[model samples]
Target: MVVIAKELLQYEKDYIKYYINFPKIYYKQENDKDYIKNEMIESINELVFEDIMNFMGVVEDSYNISSEEFIHINSITEFQVGYASDNIMSLAIEFSQLAGFYDISYLKGYNYDFKLKKEIILKDLFRESVDYIKILKKYIWVQAKTLLAELQKNEDESLYHIVEDNICLDEENTFYFTSEYLVLPFSSCEIDQEILNLLEFKIPFNKIYHYLSKYAIKNIVKKIVL
Candidate 1:
């Protein structure tokens, strides 16, 4: 089993203050533990710096008032372990802040292989020749239709077309996994709908078993059965 420790990184400046919460993962083997821990920290640091710079740009563009009229910006990052067992570990880090007239939220997912000593991407779990994007998009559409039906019950019919046009997996970080399901989390910003807060689609492993790579089948599928 992999052991995890919580670590907090805080940054403060003239108009910005934020706290980043991450995990320091460990294993029984010293070498393995050090390898995974170092890699995770390095990646997290890069993300944090990138967000800080992005926020600075937004703040500069949003406000023109003096320091006295400025509102303090506080960004908070929280992390959760979606699944961790054997050689596979999946983590989700969520960052939130108030920017301009919007509450901006971003989710970053990391799937690390302890044995491989590297982070996993979406393609890593699927067969090399499989058209995973097309397959996943089909599932997305099915879910969207169901959601549209629900919306039409109480909302205007115009939302149906809007949801259809905006729903898609534009990037890879939107996906992660648990023991029983593959999770796709789409925030309002991603779906291009101000009315929707978050739309999370949890696709069961059985639904996509045929497209899984041998490595994924052995590590994720079979391991889950036991």
Candidate 2:
């Protein structure tokens, strides 16, 4: 089963804004907006939990984990971050390892029923949630960089250069690129397909598909997927 990381969910504009602004909410006691906080929490719950479930159900017949697992992971991640205090990268690495393990295990069809039990233990130990907004921001940047690299390496040979902008292109082309673009520095948001379609470059679908598959397998397997 192909598991789309929570990072991908952040590509959506609303998700990016929420994650980026969440740290500010936590820091400001005077300007605290409970409504916005609650709304952000709700959005996180829906996007991180509900969307994961939907993806798993659609892509794989069965997923080992439950919504509670996500809650537990989030809670534990927050706790670890608080405890570590100064070690944000460590916290991110730990969180990434846990997420990767969960995804890999689910794909391998191992520990199908025990996932929730494990999550329960993690959640129970969590007292204060950590500020993962910064880490998420960094992660988004990384994704954007990776996406840009992929586009550069595998885009049609006829294509000279790729340009990315906030503007949406008309659907007169073969592929309809989603508004979901990654944050910059670590990763770029421009997809090659979008460039090809917009520039009217006639690349074969099979070649594009193969290139994407190879790229995903290489990067995901080597870096994020573990």
Candidate 3:
């Protein structure tokens, strides 16, 4: 269980915005039409995997931290693949099970050691979990960059140049751009606070929160407008 400080969560958001958004903004101003489309597509593709993995990883890490038992590392590896395949429901189930294990383990640990308060252990777990999530996010971003570079090489000339240009933005700017762009839909649905809370170590179940929030909003809007 990792407890992420609110300030650190904000820092992550700021880092992403500064690193990711600057280039897209600059390129949008350049009137590079083909490049813009390709850049957007590439961004969307990268986010499709990154966002899911982040959410799932955070939940699992939180669970592990609270429990103090090394969740078989295989569980994390399985989630990475499950999420990449877009099996979000299945991912949520797996994550929740992991969280349950953490909660139960923490309780047992407290009973075994009368000196440690439950709250203290819980808080420590949360902090460690957040640290783990942050590390995983960085690793996934690196993988996305490599994949994007290879894809750009095979793409049309105009598109390749556009992506290349955007990629040239400093890391902070690029992160900023990508987080803002990809998170828009989630934010518009009014799940921004929920997402922020998950990042802040205030929430225990990110996967459930995210899936339910998004699904509920989509359904409500569909009923109202359609």
Candidate 4:
């Protein structure tokens, strides 16, 4: 898919304002361009709307966000790009004016499947790995629990639940990869205050290699040495 449009999707109010730094992707595959475009647009719409719902809220309620200490909901927006030669795209919400609370931002990944000529989401990357999901959850919680203690808080247990639910080991979490690891983005509320970007939780590709699909492993293998 090629990005045919990049524009702002905006909403404004006296106290609350929201927008998405939207990138409209169009399919380029010759045979199924129309079908692919239809599917991709629908996928992007659903995903982006879900993002709005998850984030759009008043600072005084819902998330219990600190309105007194921080500014009101100025804008809920994201910047995204096709990553790794357009194999997948990564988007991260611009989290600001949240009383310096690290829990306010998130990262997401999207992909266009070459074989299927359709857009694939984060969940499709691991949908078949039920057993692997169980093991990965254990590892993530184990690591998160360690961080919680370092932060000197008893909230780690609750934080674990938050991340776990988002990570249905299916499709809820945002993730991408680098030359070495599959990166799982987390809000500081779930991990720790020290992590400020998409580099929230990096797991070595080797650790989860067995659980990934053949197609996924092909993309990952390029980044990580076996």
lDDT of each: 0.69, 0.24, 0.24, 0.54
TM-score of each: 0.72, 0.20, 0.19, 0.58
Q: Is candidate 2 or candidate 3 better by TM-score?
A: 2
Which digits, one per residue and each the tens of the lDDT, describe model 1 over residues 134-154?
788778778878876777798
Which has the greatest TM-score? 1
Tens digit of per-residue lDDT, candidate 4, span 170-192: 35566665535666666544443
* Reference-based lDDT, residue 8, model 2: 26
Candidate 4 backbone collisions, by pair: none
* TM-score: model 1 vs. ground truth: 0.72
lDDT of 3 by residue, 34-76 (tens): 3233343345335434643564455555545654453332122
- Model 2 lDDT per residue over 1-226, tens place: 1111233223222111111111111111234443323343344335434434443343222213443332222111111111111100001111111232342111100001111212111112112343223333344444445545766687666343333333223212112111121111111122333332212122222222222333223322122211
Model 3: lDDT to the true structure: 0.24
What CA RMSD would candidate 3 show?
Answer: 24.3
- What local lDDT score does residue 165 receive in model 2, on the 0 to 100 scale? 34
What is the C-alpha RMSD, rounded to one decimal, of candidate 4? 6.4
Residue 197 error, candidate 1, Å: 2.2
> In each prediction, how many residue pairs overlap at the backbone (N, C-alpha, C within less than 3 A)?
0, 8, 29, 0
